[model samples]
Target: MSSTQQPQPVLNCDDLLELIPAYAFGLASPKEQQQVESGLTTCPEATAQLADYRRMQDDLRESVPQIEPPPALEDRLMAAIAAEPPARRRMPQVHRAWWAAAAAVVALVFSNVYWISRSSSAPPKAPDTNSHPILVQGDSSFVLTSSREIRWVRLPSAQKNTDATAVLMWNVESEIGLLYVRGFPPLSAGKTFQLWLTMGDAKLSAGTFQVDETGSGALLFNVTAPIDEYTWARITEEPEQGSSEPGEAVVVVGEL
Candidate 1:
């Protein structure tokens, strides 16, 4: 039997250096954000670049003059409010001692109505199905639901490929998914492909694998978090030991 080949370095220091500004500004994807953080830990030069960007942001803020609104603005606003119809204006004054007490009651009523309307108007949250027991099949495939309404996500290649294709099928309720890739070049020495799940500003690793000589690969991952919480899945090339963070070399991306 043949041994598995190790992954090679696909991205170098210079490539990561170019991504620092985007990473610092929170414009980079979660995977890229992880890469920047990892680079900062290993490379002093990347760390200095990050510090420079931070200092520049601070300097930009300091350069702007802090302007305050005029003190009379509040009084003028109150005068306008007083001029409006009673329905739009502040409540009429009761006896001076009781005014505060009456105002508090009005505020309480408004607060209750506001809360009731908000509760009724807002959409209900999706149920969390992660706690439910999963079902496994004889083929080793499992699903979260008996009906198994699977969502198919087509992953776009970083390099345009008419022949290359990748897809992910997952049940939002089950959070169990499979990734299939075809017509991708096998990794070079010291390089491996890693998968990531992105949720808002955070990214979590799904796992890693290599393609066969035919340029085909597959991965089965059980999402630990609720599937609704994640936004996308991404694949990137990294070194044999694998990266704690993703590199700039994105191979494929699929929206969740």
Candidate 2:
């Protein structure tokens, strides 16, 4: 259709102009043409205003500027870039480390053989199962906290309101179990540490508990479903009223 040809209107120009918004909005019916004609008789100024607006819009569409991006855009971007420290000049990929590693392995093998020979030559050492509880004689115990596992060597006797260490081993049976703590930080008024078993669709609450002045307390926790379920265990600080769900930072966590 030519631009000059107005869409074949059922209403006259005077009637159509009056119904411009509704007509422009495609809402004018053939029966409403009389009412539209009556409106134009009293509102010719509105028609002129709409015409002026349409002309201004057309002019703007043709005149809007489209300029190229500034050359400094590249310079500005480059200036913002921090030159990465000479990539640490990757150490030459030679088999030198492997050779060193091979040498260490040889030394370890020789040392192990020598120790085995010495042990076979010498008599067996006496057992100390009380202080060191392990299935085997030479096996050592390591303290594993709620956070992460740590190799326990010589730990000082635990004092009240202080961290304590102990040999903790998780049996595959209890995927997540309680770490009844003692000699640790006491809970502030109206707050407690909550344990969680994040295994399934929803987090399972172990229990909301606190420590006493002696720092003796039991944190009740259930392993995730399926008995030997692999789950991430965590402890979070919660309101004294207790939380229906987890609502604090994870104070401790460990995989079981």
- Model 1 accuracy (lDDT, Cα): 0.61
Q: Which residue segments of model 2 deviate by more than 4 Å?
A: 1-171, 174-176
C-alpha lDDT score of every prediction, in listed order: 0.61, 0.45
Clash pairs (backbone) in predicted model 1: 7-190, 7-191, 8-190, 8-191
Work out candidate 1's RMSD over C-alphas. 21.5
RMSDs, each prediction?
A: 21.5, 27.8
How many clashing pairs per prediction, in order?
Answer: 4, 0
Best by TM-score: 1
